[model samples]
Target: MVGLLLVVTLLTYIIPAGQYARDTAGNILTDDQFSYLDEQTPVSILDMLMLLMDGLIS
Candidate 1:
């Protein structure tokens, strides 16, 4: 499981992040507003650990 997480983390760094502009209501993507995000926010190991612990409690 740890190995898979590491692989996914590496992949995230390699892949560029992106986002779509939402509509006025903020519930829909209006037209072709798809765009790359201004920055890359990769998942941290601590974040992953927190998620794992959250899953345990759930």
Candidate 2:
């Protein structure tokens, strides 16, 4: 399981970042406005753990 987590952590660096276009209403627009970001944001193990905890709590 630790190895799997390590692999997933590494894959986050390989994946390109992206975002959905938001309108004036501050809501995500599902139009053809989806685009990849110029920079890559890699996920840290602590962040992954925090997300996991949030999921479990919710």
Candidate 3:
């Protein structure tokens, strides 16, 4: 359906960023330091879910 296609298109841009962040946490931020950044971050469960879907598409 059109909705699914739209979701897939959006996810394509999100998932990699999450993976990149997780992988580069040490380079970008330390563990406790990163936790503070995560709190300030606006990412939500829906955002995480979309990232997961994006991974599947990739």
Q: How well is each residue in 1-58 modelled by candidate 3, as lDDT tens digits?
A: 5477566656655644322334454566334433222222445557766876898899
What are the TM-scores, per candidate, against the unseen true structure? 0.63, 0.54, 0.30
How good is model 1 by TM-score?
0.63
- Segments of candidate 3 deviating more than 4 angstroms: 1-39
Q: Model 3 scores what on Cα lDDT?
A: 0.53
lDDT per prediction? 0.85, 0.84, 0.53
lDDT sort, best first: 1, 2, 3
Q: Which residue pairs clash within candidate 1?
A: none
Q: Give residue 42's error in model 3 in angstroms.
A: 3.9
Query: Tens digit of lDDT per residue, candidate 1, span 1-58?
Result: 8899878877777889998899889999877887898889887778877878899999
